[model samples]
Target: MSREKTKGMSIIVKTITRLTVGLVLLYGIYIVLHGHVSPGGGFAGGVIITLSFVHLVLAYGKDTALKKLSKARASFLENMGAILFLSIALLGFMGGYFFSNFIPKGEPFHLFSAGIIPISNIAISLKVGAGLFSIFVALVLLKLKPTSEKKK
Candidate 1:
């Protein structure tokens, strides 16, 4: 296959994506981490994170995006996130309730102030981000499959 056929998009789009994709991923992480103190939380941050990968897929094609994060890895991360969140909630039983705030609440407006909340947010972001990305990948794969195979 020719270079243009294998690689996706124009050089300009690829260059711009290379420059901005990391920033977009970082912004998503920032949102997830600061969810307790800011307006954006796990769900919004997850969407942003998924967008970063989607951007890559659009700019560099499915092959490149899959190389960065394969279907198996995405599924693994999604499962891990759910497990972590569940473990956190289950641990709250030690505090006499489900999903209780067992960790010490530090000073307000600080990074570590919310304790378990931040941790929970991280777990949620992982689950949401990976799950959404997995869904996107599945849809892409489905669309790309041969119609005869799909019918079988």
Candidate 2:
């Protein structure tokens, strides 16, 4: 918690991480956006995004990483993601089909072509990414006390 000790890793590691984390996040978004046409989908892309933050934690330490993203925010975002995904599914009720693709599908291979699929993919990515981040935060923050300490 000391100010002096709260910094990240060595200069070299920090330099490399600073350069790479943005690219990792960008790639994750790309994967999510292109899910309908590409092999990678929401879950895979979300995991990739989560791992990038995890990489930051590994390189920088809990304090430094938590400053950028707190456990509470992660939990809130996870819930929001789930809600968004559910809402997208529920919209299908208007069309009388569960998870129906209501929006018009445009030209194939185009970024905006897949209608609800892309939206669903975004929702799933948010859910998956926030869930994984929450898990990572929990695991990193947890601490186990000795049995004797509990008795006292």
TM-score of each: 0.91, 0.89
Model 1 agreement with the true structure over 9-74: per-residue lDDT tens digits: 988999999999999999999999999998999999988999999999999999999999999999
Candidate 1 local Cα displacement, residue 126, angstroms: 0.5
lDDT against true structure, model 2: 0.89
Backbone clash pairs for candidate 1 read none
Residue 42's lDDT within candidate 2 is 96
- Clashes (backbone N, CA, C under 3 Å), per candidate, total 0, 0
Instruction: Go through the candidates in order and give each one's C-alpha lDDT.
Output: 0.94, 0.89
For every candidate structure, what is the RMSD over all alpha carbons to the true structure, in angstroms? 2.8, 2.4
Candidate 2 local lDDT, 1-152, one digit each (tens): 67665566777898899899999999999999999998999999999989889989988888777888888988888888899989988998887888988898999998888879998899899899989999988988889777997789
